[model samples]
Target: MTFDGSWAEGREAPPAPDAPDGPVRATTSGETRRWLRPPWVRLIVLLVAFVLADTVVGGIDQGLDDVPVVGLPVGVVLAALVLFAYVKAIRFVEHREVAELARDGAAADVRRGTLIGIVLFLACIGIIAMFGGYHAGWGSIGAMLTTFGLMCAVAAAEELIFRGVLFRIVEEMAGTWGALVVSALIFGALHLVNPDATVWGALGIAIEGGLMAGAAYAATRTLWLPIGLHLGWNFAEGGIFGVTVSGSHGTVGLLKGTLSGSAVLTGGNFGPEASLVAILICGIPTVVFLRLAARRGRIHPRPRRASAAAAEH
Candidate 1:
């Protein structure tokens, strides 16, 4: 299916005042051609925007962490800024209005995603508990609040970087499957820097984090669902359950839990994100979401320069 460029309304040239005695042609020789940017160029611009936003927000996060009783508020503000920056960047670089990031039904989508994430994590915990790998108890409220703030920052940042930027651009370049594979692998590889990160953990993260989150975006065509899912998972795993998250410390949580068993089942220090149970549980919903996306024709076809050029003439 060819995109006839009609989607970018108002950018097209108006009809000539002195009409020519011929069929109207939208040729590529003038103003219309200027908007044609390659996907790679857009990707580069997106990366630059992401880095700038991250650097600025990271500094703010660090500063806020130093202050007492202000981390949550600071994190909330920074997360909002990061999301705004991402949406603005996408709109500017894509040269079109990004309506997919709209907030009309965002609350519903977020609630749905959050519920799914909580359920999936609960299943992982349940499986581990059955295997004598988890014992749960409570922790301090202050710690839980701090972890919630931090997890919100991490979730918003990652979803913007991975699903919002990388997955979106790569999909335009290489189609949906290509986007899924490339984005997922990169997401997994990025976690290698975490303490106790193993090859298995990375692979697990690829399936659970990358594919699952990308699938969420594909199904909804919005960032809110994926953001909610990511936020929910990390907050539940670390903030609530008091487990390691991607081989990093949980810092503070509501429920304290000890995990002991085979690394395959327990995910070791990398948390449930690396466990086989997580993959199985999360994979089901991921597959379902991808199928829904396919059914809805949400999977974009790769752009063809030849077709585009033909359309121009």
Candidate 2:
């Protein structure tokens, strides 16, 4: 079986105003080129590539857990290589360099995003503290460093997969708003597999990870901001504030903190990321980023089809 299309909306030039209107042609382009490199196909390929590479790197890192001296450096190398796989896959499949991972302005973007993440999480923690649920005491420096490394890897991999691969392609086909909604829902769903994940907690991750982070990516068209933001947020929650990340248990953070209060404020066993305050705070920025992205004309329009049926509607 085969499919045909006459046009791919938003991908090609529109007809001239004076050009004579004609019946939509049954497209041979998509058929011949195998669906004109369908966005869904590209999404699947890229996602598979990134996930596979990341999994391999993770396996290697985990395997080296007992090889004390060479482990960290090797893990760092693996991480870099995993990122390289993403770049390599894009070039190979998309036939272009990934502008999102481009080195230009990366440092500044990462730094800016990291700062925002730290400050935002800190504010959330502070607000929770006001309710007397958050308590902080000194924690292990070594544990903090370890947590930082882990957070960095988590941030990079996640941003690459969710924002870079998933949201980017979805935006190309469905526009920015659609991409954000999709990324958020899927990101939230993924978190449901975490320990002690509640529907509310998953929803919180959807807002923070999907909407907020996706908006940040849409604003910049770069992965650096979301990555740094993810890292900083995770580190701030687990490392500095000594809170559980998402629903992860046994997270060694910078401070030994304790929480005792309503689940709404404390986030229950799922962590402060599930708190209402966090959702509201992060949701506010999501709106800002999306508006900024729109004002900057960064949003992609929905693909148009050359069809009478579509036109009549």
Candidate 3:
């Protein structure tokens, strides 16, 4: 008996019609199985990485507290490194090479986001001032620089996790509206740990922090814009205005403004981020940005496995 030369190992060779049946050999498919991680699993990995980075950095910063002016810069560098690692790790795990994550006109995106954030925050404060809820005073330069550094680190870190990881993953899995709701709620819930946090404050954060930032990402598909917006909002609120941000005390501010009005309008001790006026101010842009994203086809669709199978029929 002669064997067929066309039979390859690990592949199911078709039964040769010319061969008289004696003993037939069976084989399995040659295709190698690869485990594709779902979006949610990737999101969990990103969150864990974030927590680890924050904890390690916090410990290091604590040790350097005795040194003057060194702790902040060191912490900033470490935080940036963590973000870089996160982006790299995610790219590897997802089997994608996203050059845009590194390049893609980052400077322009960040500048636009910063301008929008500053303008929106200033408008919120201006509205408060108009309503006699604000009193202005002067602050120190050292404090401003320190606050800027800290806020930049924070803005970059949070935006990477929320907009870069969670929002992006969820958008791919659940589409735009689903991502908007889930990300916004999670964002607001995270702020509940802050001092003097309130329900309305959390709700305000859900809309402004969650939805607005997600929309920003949806429009540009880059982290820089959200990071810049977050940096500007926090800096303008606490660093410039000298008001508490999410119930945290400000180190210093250029304007020593005192807010005194209804907590709903003034944002109470949680700063203007929790104010009703903030929701209104941020909501308009959120709508506009999301609309732009939709028009540009930037809003991603749900995974196509089931739909593709259906189409095959």
State, as a TM-score between 0 and 1, how close model 3 is to the true structure: 0.81
After TM-score superposition, what is the CA distance of residue 120 in candidate 1 from its true location, in Å? 0.9
Per-model TM-score, in order, reads 0.83, 0.83, 0.81
TM-score of the candidate numbered 1? 0.83
Better of 2 and 3 by lDDT: 2
**Least accurate stretch of 10 residues (summed lDDT) in model 1?**
19-28
lDDT of 3 by residue, 169-219 (tens): 777677767777888899999889988898889999999888988887776
Give Cα-based local distance difference scores for all models: 0.74, 0.74, 0.71
Q: Report the CA-based lDDT of candidate 1 relative to the real structure.
A: 0.74
lDDT of 2 at 297: 67
Which portions of model 3 show Cα errors greater than 4 Å? 1-36, 55-68, 304-312
Q: Which lDDT tens digits does candidate 1 get at residues 1-313? A: 1111331231322222342211111222345535536666666777777867776776676565434378777777778878787767655555554554566667766676776787789888888889899987877676677666766777788888888778877887778888999999999998998889999999999999999999878866777789888988887887778888888764447887778888889998888788999999889878877776776567776557788879999
